[model samples]
Target: MSLRISDAVVWQETGEGISLYHTETGDFRTLNETGSKIWLAVAGGGGAQPVASALSREFAGTDPALIKRIVADVHAFIGTMVDQGLFEESPA
Candidate 1:
């Protein structure tokens, strides 16, 4: 499956990262560089594996032991995004 941002939302680039506006809720959220990378990967239909790979690349210099944890975190983050009406999972 792939993820897509809500049609009711719009995003803009910011110095720190990216800002997303949820038009339906009139709420806005800011994501850091890493978060934006994850969001983009999913939004572009890259799926969970690509998101995990992207996260892995970002922390390539870090400990290898944390790889699995990072993947779990990415999945959790994606779920949270879906819960917040920021994204929807779709068939590839």
Candidate 2:
């Protein structure tokens, strides 16, 4: 599946991190540096696997187990964002 930011949400990049506002629900979220990177990847139309791969390359030389953990975390993060209505998922 591919992921995209929800139409009801708007975001801005700040000095410290990224800020997201859900226009429909008035919900607000702040993402740290790593989260912002993942958010940007998804916003650019990346699916979970591509995002995980990109992150793995960026952190190349890390332990294999840690890489697996990172991949799982990326998937979890995207899932949570979808559950919170901050992102929409569709068939790739």
Q: Write down the RMSD of all candidates, one decimal each.
A: 1.8, 1.1
- Residue-wise lDDT of candidate 2 within 6-88, one digit each (tens)? 99999999997899999999999899999999999998989989999889768755789878888888899889999999989
Q: Which candidate number maximizes lDDT?
A: 2
Worst 10 residues of 1 by lDDT: 56-65
Candidate 2 local lDDT, residue 41 = 96
Question: In model 2, what is the error at residue 45, expressed in angstroms?
Answer: 1.3
Candidate 1, residue 29: Cα displacement in angstroms equals 1.2
Candidate 1 is scored at a TM of 0.85
Task: Write model 1 residue lDDT over 1-92, tens digit each, in one string.
Answer: 77888898899778878799999999888998878988878767778768886787677546676777788788888889889998887877
How much lDDT does candidate 1 score? 0.82
TM-score of 2: 0.93
For each candidate in the order shown, give its overall lDDT on alpha carbons. 0.82, 0.90
Q: What is the TM-score of each candidate against the true structure?
A: 0.85, 0.93
Clashing pairs in 1: none
